[model samples]
Every structure is written in structure tokens, then in C-alpha cells.
Target: MVTKKLYYQDQYIRNFTARLQKSGRDEQDRFYLVLDETAFYPTGGGQPHDTGTLNGMKVHDVEEIEGEIRHYIDVPAEVHKEYTGELDWDRRFDHMQQHMGQHILSAAFEEEYGYRTVSFHLGTETCSIDLEIEYLSDEEMSLVEKTANKVVMENRPVETRWVSEEELSNFPLRKEVSVSTDIRLVNIADFDYNGCGGTHPDSTGQVSSIKMLHWEKQKKKKIRVYFVCGIRVQKQLQKKHKVIQDLTDTLSAPQEELNETATRVLLLNKELEKKNNDLKMELIEYEADSYIEKANVQADRKIVREIFTNRPMPELQQLAKRITAKTDRILVLLINEKDDKLQLVCSRSEDAEINMNDLVNHVLPVINGKGGGNNSIAQGGGERTISAEQLMDELVDHVKKISGT
Candidate 1:
């Protein structure tokens, strides 16, 4: 037998008694109990399922399986003739507020701008309504929010009625219903009429208020609007206020002056960063000149090889480039040791008769690393298995062998 949905009968039914019609375990061995009647709302249509206690056992999830509403739990319930099902009122009420608020905001958008809501998602923190239109400006969104809040303040009655296919033509439906039979429509005073199976409040005022947070364009010329309602709106406000208050204290400015203060600080930081970069470049040039002044000639090629402790790889590469640029007969082999890692840089002047990639290939295996480059410059490194001095010695010797002297 189908479980009688007591929630649709009376949305405020927190506690009820029902008979255990069936009980079994799924493929995953999760125990589930079906009842003759229940107030638990199953998960469907983007609204999450109701969670509460069934016969004192925690009901974590509820879903419809073959016309029966199964209350999935960790443990099976006691086989009593009459079982007690208690709804978690706080969670139920929060969902009610959000669902009802979505209806109002969606109707307002349609009523004002003809933007029909194509989708709705009731999330733990926020609710989103995907509209049929693509672009929605801030001012346009603000107007819709104002209209929705007006409906909430009006305290319009929220009514529901199940009508037949012939009776459907009598009312102004916002869109077509999903089911032809057992068609239920939620009516909001003289404003909105739409098909929905979700729970809602008795009046629009219970939704408290509707605030549009943001909106974005979707793939198919649709716009998704994110918003909060009732309790969530208050929570969102509190969170934002705390952030603003923290910023004011940190910047030593008032709330109204925080933006200006932040912009000024960012500009000052940019200027300081530019000056630091200029100083670093100046030091790199001086270091390059010192390395180039002392050179060893091997087979008529000036070889500049050095091992740097705790030096950056990029700076070493730049130094190698500077040295090679000064003379056509120069070959530069550089190794930098940073922390536990070692890096090597190899480069040569244009007229130098050697492919640098070959030198890098010979040394990469020694450090257990990988690298790739063209004939002009090649570099690679891995773990610091050996000291920078030892790595440099091996690299220079390989270059000497390539020189064939």
C-alpha cells in the first residue's frame, strides 16, 4: 500500500503515529522502514528530504521507492503495530521559508519582467532560481527584490489545491504542470499560481523577506539568480557585518572610509614592489660582471663555471646569459643549491661550437632529474644528492670532454 503523505494533509504535523507496513535492507545493506502513513517529506524537485526520528531511531533520509516512502536509517526500527514519527521542526520550517520565498521572488520576476523561473535549488545556505532570460542588471534585480518583499509584507495567503485537467484552464497557471493527474497547484493570493510538490508556509509573511545576492548568465541564454530568505538573510547580513567590522579595526578607519583606505594601501604596496624589483636587477648585473671577469680557457673556449649556495635558479640563468652575451667563445656552466634542491644552467655564446643540450643531458641523470632545451641553452636538476661544488665539477668535466682537448 502507498504511504499516506501526512505532510500534504497538514504541513505542521510534527508528530504522528503510523503502522510499519514493510522493512528491508538495500544492496548497500542500509536499513529502511516503510510506514502506512508518515509526515516525512521525501527528497525531490531540488528540495531536500525531511530528517527526524522514526520510533526513536534517527531517520537520516526519506525517499519514495515503488509508491512507498522509505525512511532510510542506520538501524531497523522496532516492529510495533503503531510507530511514532517526529519531524525536525526547525529544519522543516527553514525549508518552508526558503521554498515560499522562492515562489514569491520568482513570481515577482515574471510579473515585472516576464522572466520565468526555469529551475530552483533550495540549498543549505542559499536558494537559487534559474530564469529564462540571459542578462539581469543590478537595478533590475533590485526592483524584483523590492516587489517580492512587498508581497511578503502584504502577508498574502498561500493556498494549495489539487485540480483535474479540465479544471486547470480555470486558473492562470505560470507554466504547464508536470503531471496530468494528481496535479497540485500552489496559489499565492491573487499573484502566482504554479505547480509544485514542496512545502510552504500559510502566508507570505512567514517567508520574512527576500534579498537577491547575485546573478549570472548561464549557457543557454538563461540567468541564474542567487538569493537568501528569512533566517538566512539575517545570517548573511551578520557575516558581512563582521567582515566589515574586522576590516575597519585592522585599517584604523571607520566603516564608510574602509574602501578608500584599502585602495590607498594597495597603491603604496605596488610602488614599494617596483622599487624592490629594480634593486634586485641591479644586484644581478653586478654579480654577473664579477663571474665573467674570472674565466678559464680550455681548448680556446673561455669556460665560466661556478657553484652558488642558496641561490635562485632564475638568477643563475640570468647570470649565465649575461656572461655568454659578452663574448662569442664563452661557455657558461652554473649550478645553484637552494635548500635540499640543486639546479644547473648551461648556455654558450652564438659562435661557440657546442650544443648545450648535450651537456644538460649528461648531468640530468646524475641528479635524478629531467630537462629539455635547444642547442643554445639547456638546464635541469632534481634532489641535492651531491653538493653544488661536486655537481659543478661533473658538469664542467663533461663540457671539457665535449671540447675534445
Candidate 2:
């Protein structure tokens, strides 16, 4: 078995005694260095590796390939001439805080609710633990967070020790041992004891704080919990405080009144939308009346027609539909100014010889544009060219020819 330096001693952060075991090139041409023992934690047990310097070279990644701990480093041959290594204490301490926090939380869940943590993952942003229970309600989660933080403030000492296979068999462990032998168990005093290989704080108090972010049901028998610990808890509180202040300022209300103010604003927006729809329908009725009165020939034969308006495109399309419903032999071409562009709408009578689809194919290219539609109606919008009147007249002439009117 490969010797793990951290497994035996967790406090020895920097040393010059570690010997270079092997040096070779990987598949990517990058050099991989192995050491007899290392302070660098390998990527395992859902926790990332520790990064530092090995033999004066920057160690970028450390991984456990098979049973060997391989360190990927960037360095010249001269740097490897002497034996030296350094551990990144800041990162290592953060992992310690998170890992110990997990122990406290896992134990609290089991002690209070009889929930067992079946799986745990330590990520860069947040850590997660999957419970054997199907679900944890919001009330239970709030209680768990409160209890976990209380334990952190209590600053209980965290202890670790190696027990023989026989000793481990007698002790009351929270979970069954998965490893073969020489089990190193971390005990959060009076709270939790589990088989874990990840680095952790010397005491539960070093965690500072623990916050349960949320939980979700993963399967019929599993629930996943997301949480942060130590400095992460402070960051979350700072961010939420700023958001609440911003909302209070924007709504011109007290922080306690922000929710009521937001609800009122949403109700007002809904009322405005209903009023706008009523106005659009009234505008369509007025436009349709004028177009029907001005139609020169109203018969069973197809009649191509055009209308120019300053109204919006949606209103114009509604007007065209209203006009088509009044005449059995009418084809309508309509245009309107909207924003900075011109909108077009074409509607064909059921008995009309011309189809809007054929007319759109003929005219869209004239305006250096593209459009498509079905047999009854087609609509498109494009950049304005000259006046609305001139563009409308040109389109009407094309429609007349296509309809054979």
C-alpha cells in the first residue's frame, strides 16, 4: 500500500524530509512527480486536492491514481535537484472548516431526527450531504441550522485516532466501516463519529458557523442538503443584507414593508395589461369601420386593397381581420409605423383568387426583406423606406396585379 503522509500526521504542513519517489511524463507531456509522503491531499472522497509547491515547482493538481498519489507540477529540471515542499495553509484550513462542519451537521441530523447521511460531497462553492430519509421539511431544516450553529459556538474539540479492526468492531460508529483495515475515525466530541479520510478542523469551534442553504428530495428514500460553513456563512449573510437594503430603497418603504410594496406593484401591472387589451380592441373596431366604408367594390370577386395607419402592427393586424370578416370578395394589404420600422399585414377573402402567401413571396424581396405566411393571411415588418403613403401605394399596386383586380 502507498504511504499517506497526512493519514499519519495532519499538523506537519511544511517539510524538507519527503523524498521524490518517481518522475515521469504523462500522456499530455506534462511531468508527474510522486513523493514517498506528502502534505498535499489527493483528490478523493468528493474533496479536491491540495495545491502548493513540490521541490520548488508549482504543484497545480494532485490526484490518486490507483494507490499512488501523483502531483502534477510545472517546473524545470533544475528545481527538482533538491527536496522541498510547502502546503497551502489557507486552502487546507478552508477544507478543514468545511469537513468538520459536515460532521457536526450529519451528527445533529441523526441525533435529532434519526436521519443518516449516506453520501457527502465537498465542492468549491458549497458542500452537500445526502440523507437516507426521503424528505426533510422546512421546519426541520430551520431547526437543524439553529442547532448546528449552536454547536459551532460551543467549540467542541474534534478528535481523531486510529483503531485496530478489532477495536473498531466494538465501538459504536455512526455508519458501517467501508475500508478494509487501519480505520482512522474522526470524532466530533459527544456528537458524531464517522469513517472519513478528508482533512478537518481540530475542533468544532473552528468552523465558526454553519448554515443549511436548502434541501431537496432526490429519490423515494434520499434527500440532498446544500450548506456552507465558516467564512461562507458570513458571505451569504452579507449578500442577503445588501439585497434587502436595495429592495427597501427602490420600493421607498421600510425593510419590513418591502414585500407588501412588491405585491402592490405586481397587481398594478396586471391591471394595466387588462386596460391595454381593451384599448386595442376598440382601436381595431374604429379602423375596420373606415376601411369597409371606403372599399370601392364589395362583391364575390377578389378585391385587393391597402390601408396606411400610424397605429401599431398588432392593432393593424386586428383591423385587417375585422375587414375580411365583413366582405366575402376582399383582399387587404395594410401598413403602419411602429417604433422605427414599417409593419405590414395582408388578409385574403375565402373566395378571393389571390393568396397572401403568393403575394408575400412577390413583394418581400422588393423591400429587400423576407416574410412567410399561409393561404389566408401573412404579416411582416421591415425598415422604413420613404413615406408610409409611397410604400403603401407601391404595395397596393402589386396586390392588385396578384389578385387580378
Candidate 3:
């Protein structure tokens, strides 16, 4: 048996009496109760389903399957001869306001700039419509918002009428209808006429207000215009005002000086960062000089092996480069055991005969790591199973074998 949809007759019907038809379980083991007539709207047309109570059971979801409107409850309900369904009016009215506002805003865009609405979405906090146009300038957006607000202020009646497919030509429709049979067209006076199944307010003024927040290019020639209506516009304004006030207080400046104060603060931060980096580089250079003095001299070739605690990887590279630059007879091997992980860096002078890449390749597997580099320099990191001192000793042994020492 097909469930009669009562919402089409009255969108403001908060309570309805219906007859219980059947109760059953689906393949997913979910219980559902069917009614002979229902005012709860099922999920369709970019709008969500109505959530309320049915026969004292919490109705989490309402769906129309095949020909029956199933009220999926949180728990199994006993079959009753008569059932009472209550609608969540706040949710229902909010949807009506946003949905009706969408029709007006979309119509305003079309009337002002010939932009066609291709799709729409009623989100939790906002609503958006996709337009066929590639871009919408700020001025064009302002004009459309102004036009929509003017319609809302005029308090025009919103009428719904059932018409046949042949009768559709009698009205100026903004878009084509999807269903031929049971065609319900929502008309906004002479402004907009389109086939829609969603619920809406009785008048344009009930939408309260419509505010276009912003717009962005979605894909190829489509632009998504984000907006809010009714109570949401006031919410957005309150949030923005609080943010501005906080910024004014924190910066010790008035609202008018916020832009200039922010720019000056950012510029000063950049300068401080540059000076800090210069000082760090000078410190690393001096540390490199001390490392060269503490090297182990072998066969007239200087070898520098050191372990650091929580030193940055870049500083290790810079120290290696500085040491190698000072002398062509030196090989630098550096490791940092910071953060309970092992990291290695190997560098050699330009005239050094040893291939640092080959040395790194041999040491990496011992700690389950991977790395590769040119003949003069290489870097790698791995697990901390072995101490940094152990890796350094292994690297020295490899160098000795290469030098036949």
C-alpha cells in the first residue's frame, strides 16, 4: 500500500493522526513501521528527512521504499491500530526558511545576470547553490543580494499549485520539471515558478533575510555561491563582530588601524627571523673550528667523528661543509641521537679519494635505514637500536679498510 504524503498539503503540520499499516525488519536487521498516512518528509531533493517521534518511539530516519514510507525507529515498536506522529517544528521551520530563501536568491541571480542555478545544497550551518557562470564579481554578488532582500521585504505570497505536464507551459518556469505526474510548482508571484517537492514558508518575508556570504569557482565554468538566511545572518554578524573586537583589544589599536598595525607586526617578525638565522650561522661556524682541532689524525689524514644530542640536521650539514672547506685532507662523520632516533652525515674534501656514498650504503643496513649520495657527501637516518658511538666506530673501521690502514 502506498503511504499518503500529508506534508504536500500543509508544511506546518506538527501533529498528525494516522493508521498503522505494517511492521517488519529489513535485510540489515533494522526495524521499521509503516503508516497509512505520514506528514514526515523523507530525504529527497537536497533536503534532509524530518526527525521526530512516532507512537512514542524516537524516529531517527524516515525513508520511502518502493511504495511504503518507512519510519525507522531507534527501538522496535509494538503494532498499534492508531499512531500519533509529532514533527520537530524548529528543524522543519528552519529548513523551510532556507529552502524558500534559496529560490528567491537563485531567481534574483537569473533575473539580474542570466546565471542559471545548476545545483543546490542545504548544509548544517549554511546553504549554497552552484551557478553555470564561471565567475561572479563582488559587484554582481551585491546586486543579487540586494535584489533578493527587496523581494523578501515586499512580503510576497508563496503559492503552491498542482498542475499537469501539459499545463506547465502556462507559467514562466525558471527550470524544467523532473516529474510529469503529480507536478507541484512553487510560485513566487511573478518572480519565480519552478517544480519543487521541498517544504517552504507561506511568504517571502518569513525567510526573514538572505545574505550572500561568498562565492568560489567549483569546476570548469561553475561557481558555488555560499549564503545564509533567517537567523543565520545574525549569527554570522555576531561571530565577525567578536573577532574584530578581540583583534582591536589585543593590538592596542582601534578598528580603523587594524590593517596597518597587522602589516607592521608581520614585517617586524620577518626582520627578527632573519637576524636570528644570521646569529645561528655564526655560532655554527665557530663550533666547526673547534671540531677541526679535536679530530683524530691517521696516516696524515684528518678524520673528524662526533656525536651530538638533539642538534638539528641542517646544523650538522653546515658544520660538515665548513670543516671540509678549511682543508682538503679531512673526512667528517657526524651523528645526532636526538628524539631517540639515529641520524648520520658524512662529508669529504674535494680531493679526498674515499666515496662517502659507498660508506653510507654499508652503514645504513646495520640500523635498517636507507640513503644515497655522490662520491664526496652522503646523509642517512635510522632506528636507535645501536648507539651513535657504535655507528661512528663502524664508519671509522670502513674508512680504515678502504685506506688499507
Best first by lDDT, ranked: 3, 1, 2
* Sort by TM-score, top down from the best: 1, 3, 2
Give me the candidate number with maximum TM-score.
Answer: 1
Judged by lDDT against the true structure, how good is candidate 1?
A: 0.89
Q: In candidate 1, which residue ranges exceed 4 Å CA deviation?
A: 76-82, 304-319, 336-341, 365-368, 379-381, 384-390
When summed lDDT is taken over every stretch of 10 residues in candidate 2, the lowest stretch is: 74-83
Model 1 agreement with the true structure over 1-405: per-residue lDDT tens digits: 799998887899999998998988988889999999999999997799999998788999999987899999988666756788899999999999999999999899989999899899999998899998869998899899999999999999999888998999998998899998878889998999988899999899999989899988899899999999999999999999999999999999999999999999999999999998788788878877777778888877788888778787777777788778767798988887778888888999999988999888888888898886878888887888887888888887777787777
TM-score per prediction, in order, is 0.89, 0.75, 0.88
- Among all windows of 10 consecutive residues in model 3, the one with the lowest summed lDDT is 73-82
The true-versus-predicted C-alpha distance at residue 220 of model 3, in Å, is 1.5
* True lDDT of residue 58, candidate 3: 85
Q: Which stretches of candidate 2 lie over 4 Å from their true place?
A: 1-3, 11-17, 23-31, 55-57, 74-80, 219-221, 277-327, 330-405
Model 3 lDDT, full chain set: 0.91
Clashes of 3: 0
